[model samples]
Target: MPSIMQRLNLRPIVLAPMAGGPGTPELAAAVSHAGGLGSLGAAYLTPAQILEAGAAVRRLTRGPFAVNLFAPQPSVQPTELEVEQATAELAPFHSDLGLPPPALTTQADIDFGAQLDAVLELRPAVLSFTFGRLTARQMEALRERGILVIGTATGLEEARQLEADGVDATVVQGGAAGGHRGGWLEDELADTLALTRAAAGSVRTPLIAAGGLMTAGDVRAVLEAGASLAQCGTAFLRATEAGTSAPYRAALAAAKAGDTVLTRAFSGRTARGLRNAVTEGIGQPLPYPFQNALTRPMRAAGAAAGRADVLSLWAGEGVAQGQEGSAAQILDGLWP
Candidate 1:
């Protein structure tokens, strides 16, 4: 059997699926065309949108690419009081954005099964997931289709679990990683090198090191530590093809390495982003999806008006290393 890297024909560089708005088909394809594996962060996308994104990437490159989705978590039904409190906290921000009062409803996340069906149909070179693990049946289905499955882990235990669940590879997301942390257990954090070494030592699956990796030296360090590839997200945010909002791009340009914090204010899930007013004031909001929905209008308005304070400026600890250029240019700089 071919080694995982040999099978994928990867260039020791993998583009992290940034999800939400920053990840775009054009950006994914551009990176893949450059000999790295491009990935679409499809966690927030509907099934139809996932297919459309795959089509978009196909139009741009025939190289192997990956699509990532969030593993399903049990629904957390917030108390009416919880919803009201979250709404009240966000109401002022909504008003400041010239939007209506926050009115939230019971919304469902995109069906994971449906999303998997679409992914299987599109048959991207790889399918990766975070936040949780896939069941034996899910893994079996993917394997039967000859699709490689990758899972994200933040610690050794999670890495072992993914190996047991039959993931072909795993991404060890370090604390310096931007956006959502990948550990599904409690919030135990470690830097990229530590987690990568730990996972590589503990799991049989090939490891992909992620988080805070900005330069070719950083990539080399992780590979030397036993990672088969390095996946980068924040470093690629400024890529011209990325769907990063103008305000986000500006924030990245202005941010220093330590200017970010991990907070649940934006989406009720702990994610790293540049320190802004929203991350400062908002006390604990509702859980994910709910908090994410409650703040949607404010975020949308913030993006429209180019206001950094109201948008979810998801970035890794390596923001200072990001530069404005095409995805291919950014990849060359990171790998060369």
Candidate 2:
């Protein structure tokens, strides 16, 4: 089989899949149409939603694109005491937003098996995952269908493991990356360039560098460091076709240096984003899915009402460099 790079026939840029509303089919298709490998973040989407989204992207462009999901994690639930404490902490924020007390355990996890089945049916050019590696059987199924698989890594060890697991490519997500930190291994997070170089030297897999990549220079630097492609998220947050809300777009435009910080307040996972009331207020979040569910109502309300304070404004360290434009324009700017 030809490699993922050959199958994609892509430019040097890959669009980082911005889940939780920012990543739209139109945005993904637009980037793909512009010669970059666009991505739809399908972590929270139901199987039907994923199929509909994949069809929507197909309607927009014939270019190759990727659909991404968070690898399945073992089921865990917050204790009743943890839920009560978290709810109590979130009470004021809810009241301020004219909402009821946060329902800490109301949200249920998406069924990953169904999600995978939907992806196999959609048969996109690429399937990528983060948080953890896929089971060997899952990997074999993707390979059987001629679908390329990519896994996320935050350090050399993760990259090595992803290669060993038979991923077609590994996205080396450094510390400067936006959204959820995808590294599940114990190794420390390295900068994009450093990790890319280290992984390039250690593994045979093709590398896609992600993190703090705002301009063409950043993309070029990562490629020079041994990445075959550079993936960008924050740089496209303001892309015209993205589903990023009005308040979020405003927050991105107004963000200053040091405004973005890694916080677990929103999703219980350590993710990079702009500092706001939620980040400043929450002491400790329960954990992924639990914290993610606990804040869903507030975030949805904040998004609906154009309030930036309560929403998860996930961004990277390069928030200052994000510019407004079409997805094509954004990709053009990032491609050297």
Candidate 3:
């Protein structure tokens, strides 16, 4: 049988599955139709929504696309004091937005098992996960169905771990990649080329390099460095088919490449993005789900009201290099 990459029929360009909003079904299908693998950032979606999204993508293109989800994370059992502090920290943002005081909920995290069940049923061509690796049983299920598994890694140790766990491929996410950092092993900050070279040397699994990849030349350099393919997120934030908010798109356009800063202010996990008031204001947040949920309403209001300061405008170090075009056009220009 042909390899998974061969089955993908790709153009060495894979969409980076920009969760939160930018990775829309329209964008995914457009990239797939253009001969590159497209991905749905389904981490935040419920099981029903995941199925609906899969159906929507199927309707748009017969080509295969990947569905991405966050691996199951340890539920943060925050102390009452921690919850109080988090709510207090977000209260000002809520007040400014004319919203109710931020409240802590028992159900802040997505149910990964339920989400996995949904993915099994949806059964896209590929399944990619980040933040951690799946269990043996979970990996077995995906393999049994012939769904290629791609796990994210930020360094060599994690890459080896993913291979040991039986992933079909590994996404070597450089520190400069946008959005949440996927490094579970000691907050990896290696450069993309360095990490890719290290993993390519150490692991037998195919490597996908992600981070600050904006042009065909950038992709080529990574490929030469031994990456099998290049995955890009920041480059596609402005694609016409993307669901990026107006304020977020504006921020990306206005940003210099150096404007992005790493902060856990919005999501309670370290992620690189455009610096704003919220990130600067909130220091030492609760954990992932708690912080992500607490700030959701404020972030939603910010996006609605066109306030970039209150929103999480995730981007990479290549902010200045992002292009404005349709997804197809972007893919063509990136790899053609």
Candidate 4:
């Protein structure tokens, strides 16, 4: 079988999917057209939206691209007491943002099976997932349809597991990675360089290094250490094509290397973003989709008002390296 890079004919760069907003069809196509594997972070999109986004990318680029989703995990519905506590905690922020109280009745209906079916129908060059792994049947189905399956990992064990489970490639997400940490089985954090080196030594499958990689040197180091490609998210946040909101883009531009922290305040899941009032105040959040849903209104308001403090300003530790330009320009600068 061809290697993942060979199959996609991609360069040593992959656009890490930034779900929620930053990942857009135009951004994906621009990067793919520039020879890297651009990815759609379809984790937050409905099945119909996923198909539409794939079509939109197809219309822009004939080059190979990938669509990423969060593997379906069992939903954790907050109890009344839990909901009350979370609501009370967020009430002040809601008031500050001039938003109404969150409706706890709204459940996160993320149908992974339906999303997968849509992906099969769209037939993008690659199908990648994080948060968790897919079942054997799902993997077989993807393989039968000729879709390359890529899994995300944060440690050697996870990489080994993905390889054993028959993933075509594994993105070794280091501690510096922005957004959610893909360490589903373990909580211990490992730096990107260390994790990539360790996973490369252990797993035969191609390793794609992710996390604080922001420059050509960063990409070269990972490739030398054995990564087949470098997957970058924060490095492209300032790219003109990214759908990053105005405030989030400003935060990325002004952010220093250590301004980000991994907090569950915004989404219940441990995701890294800029340190702000919301992150500093909240301690124990409800749970993944529940916490994510609870804070949606405030985040939306923050975005609309360009309030950086209340928004989930997701970015990696290498955010300082982010530059403003078209996606193609950013890719050229990173590789050149």
- Residue-level lDDT of model 4, residues 31-115, one tens digit each, is 9999999999999988999999999999999999999999987777778888888888988898887778766666666888999
Across 9-37, the per-residue lDDT of candidate 1 in tens digits comes to 55889999989888999999999999999
Per-prediction count of colliding residue pairs? 0, 0, 0, 0
Off by over 4 Å in 4: none
Q: Candidate 4: give the clashing pairs.
A: none
Candidate 2 — which residues are off by over 4 angstroms? none
User: What does the lDDT come to for candidate 1?
Assistant: 0.89
* TM-score computed on alpha carbons, candidate 3: 0.98
TM-scores of the candidates are 0.98, 0.97, 0.98, 0.97
Error of 1 at 68 (Å): 0.5
Model 1: residues with Cα > 4 Å off, grouped in runs: none
Error of 1 at 230 (Å): 0.3
Candidate 2 residues 203-314, lDDT tens each? 9899999999999889889889888888899999999999999999999999998898889899888899999999999986887888988899999888888899999999
Q: Give all candidate RMSDs, comma-separated.
A: 1.2, 1.3, 1.3, 1.2
Q: Could you give candidate 3's per-residue lDDT for residues 105-163 as a string of tens digits? A: 64787889999999999999999999998999999999899899999999888998999
What lDDT does model 3 reach? Answer: 0.90
